[model samples]
Target: MKKTLLISHNREKLLNALVYFSKSTRFCGKTKLFKLLYFLDFIHFRETGRSITGLNYYAWDKGPVPQDLFHELKQPDTDLKETIALLEQSEDEDYRLCRVIAKKPFDPKYFSRREKKIMEELSFVFKDALAKDMVEITHLSGTPWDKTMKEKGPGKRIDYSLAVDGSKGSLSLEEIKERMSEIKEVTEIFGDQ
Candidate 1:
C-alpha cells in the first residue's frame, strides 16, 4: 500500500532562508526574495522529494510566488511579524519592492544541511543579479511556472509535482530509504481506508 507523505511547513525555515538571502546582499528586494525562496524550495524538493519551506508556489503576474508566505507577510501580528518588519516597501514605477532591513543573524537550527547548502548556493549565484533577471530565469520554458502560465495563464497554481518530474535519481540512497519509510508508515496507519 502507498499513502501520501505527511508534510510539515516550518516558519523558522522560511525565516532562515529569507535572512540568508537578505544577509548576502544589502537589501534583497521583494522579487528577489520570492525568486530565491522559490529556488530554495523547488531545488530542494527536486533533490529530496520535499521542500524546505513546504510552500505552494503559484504562477503569479511576476513569477513563481509562494501563496502562503505572501499571505503571512501581509499580516502584521503573525509569527513572522519580526521578519515582516525588516521589509521596507518602495514603489518602483508601478511595482512595489520590499527591501530587507538589517537584523541580527538568524539562528541556524531551523535549516537542514541540504537546505542550508541550497540557500547558500542560490544566494551566491544571484548575488549580483537584478530582480528582473531573476524573474526571467524563473520563467524559463519547461519550468513549473512556465508550464502553469502556459496552460492556465497567470495566477494559477504551479503543481508541486513538477519539482520531482526529472529528479528521480537525485536523492541519495539514505534519503530514498527515509522517504520510503515515511510513506510506509503512513500507508500502514491508513491501510487504504
Candidate 2:
C-alpha cells in the first residue's frame, strides 16, 4: 500500500527520533523505543490533537507498538539500513539499541518546535530508565493501552483519539475537543498537498 504524506513524514520523524534517543539516552532498545514513541505521540496528541509520528500503535502484550515500524526493523529497508542499524541485543541489555550510522547527520527540519520539545523531554525523562519502566508507564490505568487491552482486547489498533478523554498531563476535555476539530480541518486542507 502507498503511504500518505503524513505517513511518509512519520518515517523520517521516526528515523530522527531513533537517532536522538540513541545519542541521548543511557539505554534504549526496541521496547523502550516503542514506549518513547507511544508517549511522545500520545502526549502531543493529548495536547495538540496530533501525533508526532503519524503511527498507529497496536495494544501488544508488551505495550503499545507501532507495528509498521516494527516490521521495518525486522527486515531492514535498504534506505533505512544505510542510515541506521538495530544492533544485536547483548546479554546486558533488555533491547537492541538503534544506532544512527548514516553519513547524513540527524535533521530536525520535519519536526515542529513543539515536536522537538516533546522529543527532548521524553529523552531527558527516560534517559536512565529501563525498558520495563517504560512498559510500566504505558501500562498505566486509563491510558490508551489499558483502554485497548481491556475494552477491545490485545493486538488491536489503539485509538489514540481516546487520549483526549484523560486528565493527566492533558488539556480539559472541552479544549481537547476544540483542538481535535482544528486539527481535523488542517489535516483535510493539507492532506493531498
Candidate 3:
C-alpha cells in the first residue's frame, strides 16, 4: 500500500489523483511522493498558517519538516530575512543550500539513492582536493552568517569558512557555483596566470 499525506484543502481531488498515480508502474519512491506533498504543504502553510497534517500520521509537528516542505520554504525572497528567522525557529534543519547548490531550498535527501551515491563519490573527490591543498571549503552557520549574506548577495558575500588557503585567493564554493561562466569570462578578460 502506498503511504499518503492528505492535506486539508482539495482533499478529494488530490486523493483521487494520488490514488491513480500510486498504481502506476512508473511510480517513484515514497520520498518523491513526500517531496511533492511537502511542497504543497508549504505553499498551503505560506498562503494559510495550517501545515499538512494527517498523512499516515507523519506530521511536521512530530519531526523534521518534510524534505520537500523544507526546500519550498527556503527560497529567496524580498522577505528573506524574516523568512530565514521563521525557518531557524522552526523544526527544519539549517541546510545551507547557498553553499552547496547556490540556490535556496535544496534537499540532498531528495535525490534518488543512486544519485546520492554519485554525489558521495564526487564529495570524496572534492574532499581529497581540499586535503591536498588544491581546493578549500568554507561553511557558514547560524544567524550571523545568515545576516551577512542577507545584506550581501551570495555572489559578494562569504559567510562560513570550511577550508581556506590564502595563497590561492580562489573563490569560495558558493561563489564558484554562483558565477561559473562569469568567473571564466572575467578571468579571461583580466588574463589568467
Candidate 4:
C-alpha cells in the first residue's frame, strides 16, 4: 500500500490535543488518545469539510488509529517524549491501563476555535469513560471504523466522510430532510444577497 503524508499535518496541533486529553480524568490510555484524536479530526472534517490534523485513520482491532501519529510518538527523539513519558501504564486483567502523569495546558495556537470547541465537548462527554468504553463507542453503528471493518474486513482505510453523517455515521431520512431544508434556507437567504 502507498503511504500518504498528512499534507496538512501540524505536529504541534496533535501534541496540543494530546495535552488537552491528558488533562481529562475520565479517559486515559494510548487507545483513548488515538480515539480522541481520530474523533477530533474526523468530526471536525465532517462539519467543516476540512481536517484539523489531516491524519488518516485505519480500522484497527482496537478502533480507528492514526498510524503515523503513533509512530511519531514512539520516536526516541520526539519532542513529546517528556510529555509522553509521563504516561502511566499498568497491566490490567483484560487490557493495559494507560494514563497521563504530567498533564499540561494545550497551546491554542495549534487549534482553531471550532476544533478546540469540539475537543472540549468530546473530552467532557467521554471524560468518565474507560478506554475499552471508547473502543466500543468508536465501533458503534454507522461509524467509519465499523463501516470499513464490515466492508473491507479491518486494516482498511476509513474514509473521513463517515464522520459527517453524525455519530452513528448514518443519517435517517428525517435528518437528511432537515439538512436539505437547512441548505435550502441558506441558499435562499444568501442567493439574493
Say which candidate scores most in lDDT: 2
Global local distance difference test of model 1: 0.73
Better of 1 and 4 by lDDT: 1
Q: How close is candidate 2 to the true structure, as a TM-score?
A: 0.81
lDDT (tens digit, per residue) of candidate 1 on 50-72: 67776788899789998777766
- For model 3, the local distance difference test gives 0.31
TM-score of 3: 0.22
- Rank the candidate models, highest TM-score first: 2, 1, 4, 3
Off by over 4 Å in 4: 1-9, 86-88, 102-104, 166-193
Alpha-carbon RMSD, candidate 2:
3.3
**lDDT of the structure predicted as candidate 4:** 0.72
Q: What ranges in model 1 sit over 4 Å off?
A: 1-9, 84-96, 165-193
* Collision pairs in model 3: 5-55, 137-162, 137-163, 138-161, 138-162, 139-160, 139-161, 139-162, 140-160
Lowest-sum lDDT 10-residue window in model 3: 130-139
lDDT score of residue 19 within candidate 2: 73
Clashes of each: 0, 0, 9, 1
lDDT of 2 by residue, 1-193 (tens): 2433344666788777777776777766778878888888988988777787788999999899999888877777655665566665566565445433433567899799989899999988998998888888889998889999999999999986778765676777677678768877877997622
TM-score against truth, every candidate: 0.77, 0.81, 0.22, 0.74
Best by TM-score: 2
Residue 140 lDDT (model 1): 90
After TM-score superposition, what is the CA distance of residue 98 in candidate 3 from its true location, in Å?
32
